[model samples]
Target: MKEILVLYYSHRGSVRALAEQIAHGIHQVPGAVARVRTVPRVSTVCEAVADDIPAEGPPYVEERDLAECIGLALGSPTRFGNMAAPMKYFLDGLAGAWVNGTLVGKPACVFTSTASLHGGQESTLLSMMLPLMHHGMLIAGLPYTEPALNETRSGGTPYGASHVAGQEGSAALSADEIALAQAQGRLLAGYALKLAVAR
Candidate 1:
């Protein structure tokens, strides 16, 4: 099977939910599979350390995951109009991959969740794209052709799939949000298949 890595960081489960939906979409395409992974949270205190295995949810991603995956779906909750620190930290540590061009020519998509309607989802998505771009990956966004891009009132955008998780971060994924994420997964997987065939 061709695997697409769904890498994400979630504080309140909102971004994780979107990641699952995106994985579901990837599985819709024949010969495509989703490999869900999460990043460990960073501590401000200098002495803190994360366990090798997480207590719950997906385990932290490894370099092997990046090397093996055919495509990538990166997600994170918005942190003041940017990706959360843990996600950024993980990406920053990938200089070796960048130097080796491990991700070059691969397809990638970004997703995010925000605490409010204007919580900088687009900017967060843009920030996530920067690292992927540096890795020489092809960035994919939701096109107008997807009805959810025009119809979603909660959390879908041309930049990528997003969620309005409310002030307390209590919002659940709306139907439209789920559909759009799934659509993006399918689109990305299809593109990966074509790229594989081209080679």
Candidate 2:
């Protein structure tokens, strides 16, 4: 079976919600499976640490996950128009993988959530792509043909799947957002399976 890593960080559970939908789509493709993982939160105070394993949710990701996966789906909540500090911190620690080209030619996509409709989902997605590009992964995105991209009023984007969590962070993901995310995952898994077979 070909495994696609679904890695993410979620604060209010919005990004994790999207990640699960993406994983569900990945499983829709024959011979493809999703390996869900999450990163730990960063601490502001010096020397602060999180448990090696999260209390609930997926375990913290490791470099081995990147090496073993056929493709990647990265997610994080938007933080000031960029990926959250925890996700960025995790990526920054991947210089060894970048140098070794471990992710080269792999298909990768990004997803994000924000508090408002105008809360920089596209920019956050773009920002997350930069490190993957450096690691030589091929960036995958939602095409306009995925009708949900055109119909979404809340948070779908050409860059990737997204969600607007509202001011109090209570807004559920719109149906269009869910559809687009699933479509992106299926497309990525299909492409990865094709490449694996070709190899």
Candidate 3:
């Protein structure tokens, strides 16, 4: 099966919720599958280190995931209108992949979650794209053709999928938010399949 890497950093589970919904969409396409992975949290203390494998949820992402996947879906919680430090730290370590063009010509999509409805969701998605762009990947976003994008009152955008986690950091996704996220996954997987066939 062709795999699309679903990489995310989620603290309150909101971004991870969106990632699951997006993975569902990817599964809707035949011969396509989602490979969900998460990064370890960063710490300010110099002596702290994350375990080799996380205790819960998906396994920590490895370099092979990037080198093998046909496409990518990146997600993170909004951290002051940008991707969180852990996600940034992970991306910054891809210099060797950048030099080797490991991700070149691959299709990619971005997603984010925020505590408020106006909490820089789009900016976070855009920020994730910069590193993928540097890796020579093709960036895609939802088009207006998705009805949820027009009907969503909570957290869906043309730039990518998003969720309003509420001030209390709820992880429940709205109906429209779920629909849009699934739509994004389907779109991303579709692109990956098409490119694979073309090649």
Q: Who wins the lDDT comparison?
A: 3
Per-model TM values vs. the true structure: 0.96, 0.96, 0.97
* Residue pairs in collision within model 1: none
Q: How accurate is candidate 1 locally (lDDT)?
A: 0.92
lDDT of 2 by residue, 57-148 (tens): 89889999999999999999999999999999999999899888899989999999999889999899999999999898889999999988
RMSD of each: 1.3, 1.3, 1.1
Q: Compared with the true structure, what per-residue lDDT tens digits does model 1 show for residues 1-104?
A: 99999999999999999999999999999999999999988886622765788988988899989999989999999988999999999999999999999999
Give lDDT per model, in order: 0.92, 0.92, 0.94
lDDT of 3: 0.94
Backbone clash count, each prediction separately = 0, 0, 0
